[model samples]
Target: METVAITPLDTAAGAEQSHDPLRRQQAVVALGRRAVAAPDSEILLHDAAALIADMVGTDRFLVAESDPNGGQLTLQLVTRQRYGGNKPLVHHVALDGAQSLAGYVLQVGHPVAAEHLAADRRFQDRFLSRHGIQSALAVPLCLPHRSFGALAACSSHERIFDAGDLLFAETVAHVVTTAVARCRVEQALATERRLSAGMLQTVGAIVLVLDARGQIVHINEACQRLTGFSLDEIRRRPVWDVLPVAEELDLFKSIFDGLRHGLGPVQFESCLLTKHSERRRVAWTYNTVCDAQGEIESILATGIDITEQQKRQQPEETPDANTPAGNPPSEPEERNRQHPNAADSRKVPVRRPSPINVERRSRPRRSYPYRQSIAPVQDGELPDPAEFYQVQCNDIAAGGFSFLSPRPPESASIVVALGTPPSLTYLHAQIAHVTRMRKEGKWVYLVGCSYTGRAFY
Candidate 1:
């Protein structure tokens, strides 16, 4: 019997040809572990390339990822053996011509093995001949949903890749594809979270996110500024605790209850108690956040501060009662006469003046007869005092004056008085309150008025 010696090339060929199931299984398991251990897609691709180069006995390995639109392939990871050592390279390339091995694998959605890349007329690529790559194997990183890219192993030696190499490359590609898909989903979720955070912080209105129990989960920068409480201070605390208004808390709870019952968004005005104990009026709109199963997960509250706006809109005081009689009414008086309902009815509280105070008021009493025009609520227009019925002036004050009329004046009625002793003057007044009393066996109405603006003199 003659004993034959095996050369290094023969040993290499024998290793490639061997049908060792355990060795193949171990290699597949190692690649799967590497995929799992990698933190991101780029790192995963780099590790996968190095693993393929070592296991397939190739001098170079490359991972080319296709663009999402499928028109291009970018070289994401490349591991090549050099004289000094094996160094990894990364770059991007556009796949235009259909003859490249990576392009062919991606287009056909299958694996391709070339024993001689330069000689293969099916695919003409000068890069292969220039880089001394004689043999190569490429498999598409295909998943059920979409194809990501292609993985290829190339050798400088001739006829290095075979059917066994193709199968091994395909297995590794499948493992890497799953890992890449996971990383992509994670990256998308992370990006969405960042965008949401940025919007919450930059939006003009105060924003607060609360759990089902009304505990604050998140508060934006606007909310912090409006409430004067930092997010760290209020987080996990009940939203009502910061509000500090018992009446508003009850209203807020009712609104949240409505949300739990699947009601539409609730909008209302309330006051927010600041850290310094100052009360600031705010208008808020609340919406509910639901989970997949339609359960209430969180509540989103957006609010705007209206304190300064309300202050700027307060009614101006009437001019001094001694204003001359001939002048026109002030601007606010004119405006109130034009649009009586412009003042917010919800904010203005009506109070009845004491009968004793009206009778014995400290202000001077004028019994002299004065003709005045009374604007009818129906048309909001004031007819001339001479055409309408005449009324007696009872008393006067710097802020307002009282008059006697046969009937009770309508609420929000505009009174314009032109008198002589008070000097020529026109007054714009609103009927603030009315008192009825019996005087000289006749039912007379005492009309208490407040000057809404400066009396024109």
Candidate 2:
């Protein structure tokens, strides 16, 4: 609990007047700055101990970190001075038990002042005598909320440490603690980041990370495999520049705007274009990566390419008038016996509606509310067949709704909502084609609609 006082040294003589203590303090501060700025941890610990030893004019300094199992303190970073006639102090320590100064410091939270090292009854003096050590100081290097290690400073002079010296030593101890803590945090973060990146790359899903300006910061290996683009080609490029899908670009833009407005998480899906110049359909969920102040820093995007899955469910094959029916027509006599007055009685054998058509006409369109209350409606209005049916909806963009009118005429009108009520609606959609589901017992025909209607939002 001892506080170190800062003793201002007179710099009147400039460089010549600078002592080891002053130079060492400068080194300590410099190391602290480096620790703060360092992108990695290993150098931080090594530099911090060296700086501490230099500042205190110590023959040697050893930084020992406590083992996770609480067994003993292990020497992490060590510093020894170069003497004129003697060998440099060894940096190694044998710390299998509570015997060394480092071990004692870890065991007792209080700083150890080995001022009377030679004659102390409880202390062994051989190590001190061998190194000509008359004085030693060990301060526990404790993190803000965790106790881990100690900083030991040793000298060859007896009773050399004073209140001022103790204060300075403790300050140096704090510096070491800060550096060590920062390094530990950085290592942990790096590990977590690596694991996360690995998961995104290997989990069989397309993942992407975009920066503030909507450029690709990172895309996982899976994304590359799915899209056929190299990392170098995509980096810092606008997402749409690579995959030019206006719908997807707009979706990404909305998500970015939501995050910027402090929305926590947003999810949507749209048609995507890939690096191979192939069109893809995908579902994406985005989470905003925030800074310490809860401001948006970057975007974390996780997605799955469902283009194939969707294609399989809804094939491009359209139902044509000349296409054969699921059930073949019986022989001429059998057909007449079943329906004597059928339309085919004419010499020209007028075309007859297929059984699929008869069944479809019988099933009335159920106008039940489609997720009315809890979910948003398309463009907040119903589809009008005449003018332009605008499917206005902000919700359910991932899987859009399709009109299930069994017999879709060639030019039926359709509408889709494009924005909030009183907002402009996407209109003038043309019916592309009518495709029937081939799966057994599924009889609804999908009227493919295109937005001849311009983009409103």
lDDT of 1 by residue, 1-457 (tens): 1111212223555455443556777867977886777556765665565556665666676778778787677763343433223334445556644547777777677778888788886667555556677888878887766778887777778865667767877788889899888877775676457437634643799888888888998988888887889999999998888774654565566556656655435555566899888899776767666644676667787787877775665421221132223433356664454335335211111232223324333334344345554443323445455534456766555345656777644334454655544453455565554444557986565665555543333
Query: lDDT by residue for model 2 over 1-457, one digit each (tens)?
Result: 1112222222434323334466646755776676667534334444444444445555555556676555555553232524222222433444432356666665566677777667655455355456666677778877545766776666666645656556666776776677667767775686458447644553777777776666888888888887899889889997757764753454455446655655434444455777666787666656666544565556776777766676555333222111011122225453333334332111111111233324212112222223211111133344333444322121121112234443322223333543444643443332333333333454444433322223333
- TM-scores for candidates 1 onward, in order: 0.41, 0.35
The lDDT leader among the candidates is 1
* lDDT of the structure predicted as candidate 2: 0.50
For each of the candidates, the C-alpha root-mean-square deviation to the true structure, in angstroms, is 22.8, 21.4
